[model samples]
Target: MLIVFGLMIAGGALLGGEGDSADNKSDTSAATKSGSSSDSKLKDNYHVGSVANHKGYKFKVNKVTYYDGSDFDKPKKGNRYVICNVTIKNDTDKKQSYNPMDFQLNANGNSTNMMEILTKENYSQNTLDSGDLDPGASVTGNLIGQANKNANLKLEYQPSVWNDETVKVSLY
Candidate 1:
């Protein structure tokens, strides 16, 4: 009985050795509610409203809203606003600076950075570069993008300027 129990415990440790632990939490069920795991640059994939974390920084997307320029009579007829209410947490020892430009919106395999328009005054609200983030600091704001259909929109974040690895999140 002792040998059998030891084997079982060893098996458990081997099974959980990957990045699925609580501290290194990974949502590896993208198809289901469990979320999905990372594949190299694509760290973790969340289903729309779930929080996605990478390299200690936690990102939570609160809401996604699209506005048609027709009512406001601002943008062209074909252009629409894709706004994402997002929150960023700085889990670093040194102060960090996040530029809204560092974020990208991927739709239909095409990627675009934050929108730059003259009419909209609050395009990059509460974004990463809003201020210097102290350790454990979190900032939330609305990031805008101009696209026709906001479906299959994924939010891509590169926490550090030194590396190309990104935390790709699905904002479904």
Candidate 2:
């Protein structure tokens, strides 16, 4: 009886160990498959009102508006405010962070972050803010930047800090 019990314990450990390794392998493979599939779906350029997916988040640049700035808060000479009304939806099972800083304006070989100064404007309440989004949650707001008045502008969204993949949106 004791011999049978010892053998049963040994067999269980071997089976359990193998099962765990199999589970780990499957998890890794699944992640790889999903990542590859999503990467393939990424496009070269997106336009206003178009949807772009990054990882598990859905982003849309709903509208782009230009501001010459108010009396007290004027843009630099030859520069104007570029405001993108963006919407981000968290499709992942876990919570994610959404910030205006993640959006950048690219023009004339220069990349600039959101213009935080506009956040102090009276219309600032409509500007984007850094916040946490739970699964299925969404946030929509403006990302304000300053760029040359006549420069061709492009907006880039870097969704993940771990990866350098970006979603580009043309603002013609």
Candidate 3:
């Protein structure tokens, strides 16, 4: 009876180990598939809004600023991040729906290596769905990301009305 109990305990342990390995593999495969799906979606053609002469319908890069986490005056770290505040105005005399995910930040001139900036360190999609902005209404927000100090920042936006082409505005 004692030998049988010991064998049963060992078998249970082995089974647990196998189960853990399987779970790990399953998690890794799921993560890989999830990442690939996001990549494919990003590569899809998106619409770019045309530059209109309307006073508030234009999008502008208001400012590009950097902050060092340290309070004391030390040389800015090379890895210090930059925050770009983009202002979008809706002067088309109609309501506009904007998806923040469709907006991207480009460093220097490299669009392929573009990094996503989350609103408040969360991975959630930071979209602006304020229904419609009446004529002459404007909205502003910051896109935060890690960047080299003094790096050139560009804002690329695809408007709902425009088809799949990205419009860029640079702040040097």
Cα lDDT listed for each candidate? 0.66, 0.84, 0.56
lDDT of 2 by residue, 1-172 (tens): 9999999999999999999999999999999987787754668889999998766778899999888887776888999888888999998898998778788999876999985466455457788888999999999988888899999899999867326678889998
Best candidate per TM-score, number?
2
lDDT per residue, candidate 1, 1-172, as tens digits? 9999999999888777753564354333433332322332344566557776554557777887776754443544566677787888778677777777778888777888865443555654343345667889888887777765535778777756325666666766
TM-scores of the candidates are 0.62, 0.74, 0.47
Better of 1 and 2 by TM-score: 2
lDDT of 2: 0.84
* Stronger candidate by lDDT (1 vs 2): 2
Residue-wise C-alpha lDDT for candidate 3, range 39-149, written one tens digit per residue: 323322222232322223566556666655444323336745555555677767667766566666666665422243443432224323334556677776665555556
Q: Cα lDDT for residue 138, model 2?
A: 97
Where model 2 places Cα greater than 4 Å from the true spot, the runs are 1-35, 38-40, 119-122
